[model samples]
Target: MSTESVQGGGNDPAIEVTPEAAEEALSLLEGEELDTDEAGLRLFVQQGGCAGLSYGMRFDTEPEPDDLVVEHHGLRVFVDPASRNYIGGSKLDYESGLQAAGFHVENPNVVSECGCGESFRT
Candidate 1:
């Protein structure tokens, strides 16, 4: 990741991917047989988790015309316009350890998170 701190700019991309996350995502893409020129990582926010909102990620072959697209560490990231406000300036990370291992979001916009850590409120 860059040394520069992330900030929310009106015209900036909604989210940023750390180098670690991008590399891990790329590896997963290949492992899952989803690696392709048109495939990209798609991140979005949805309602109905323990804290009322949750994050979703997947490999998408097509992106909406109005989505916020960002390219970092050789990975293409897509964020739906509706999710921009919720995840703007957030950092995507991957962690592998004895206790837990998966993709996690470090979101500055979250005001609170559920105890289980599966959801958050903004």
Candidate 2:
């Protein structure tokens, strides 16, 4: 696992997750009965989507050498080095509503977001 600090004035360039987010994810895992013993989450950015960049998340048990690992509330979250620039200072949260529910990323680097909220331009 690797970690680096984003450089800027008056900005903390680190990914953060709220307690609600952690609990929500945990609840989802429990509902799915997914094996979380060695399971972890991975977040990355990919090209495509209306805004040129899209977010990706997955569950993993291993991390690559260049992955940036973040831990919160006993949960391990991994991010690829290349995607770090786009997700700097972002927050991960879980949301549930009558219409939709899932993990959401609040990114400071996002300049614009698509109507579907599946992608962003920065």
Give one digit per residue, the lDDT tens place, for model 1 in 1-122. 44332222358545778888888988877787875455678889999788999999999985677777776776777788789989988989888899988999999999999999999999
lDDT, candidate 2, 12-90, per-residue tens: 2667877777777666656767665555678789999987999998777656766776667756667777788899789
What's the count of clashing pairs in each model shown? 0, 0
- TM per candidate comes to 0.86, 0.79
Clashing pairs in 1: none
RMSD of each: 3.6, 5.5
Q: Which lDDT value does model 2 have at 31?
A: 71
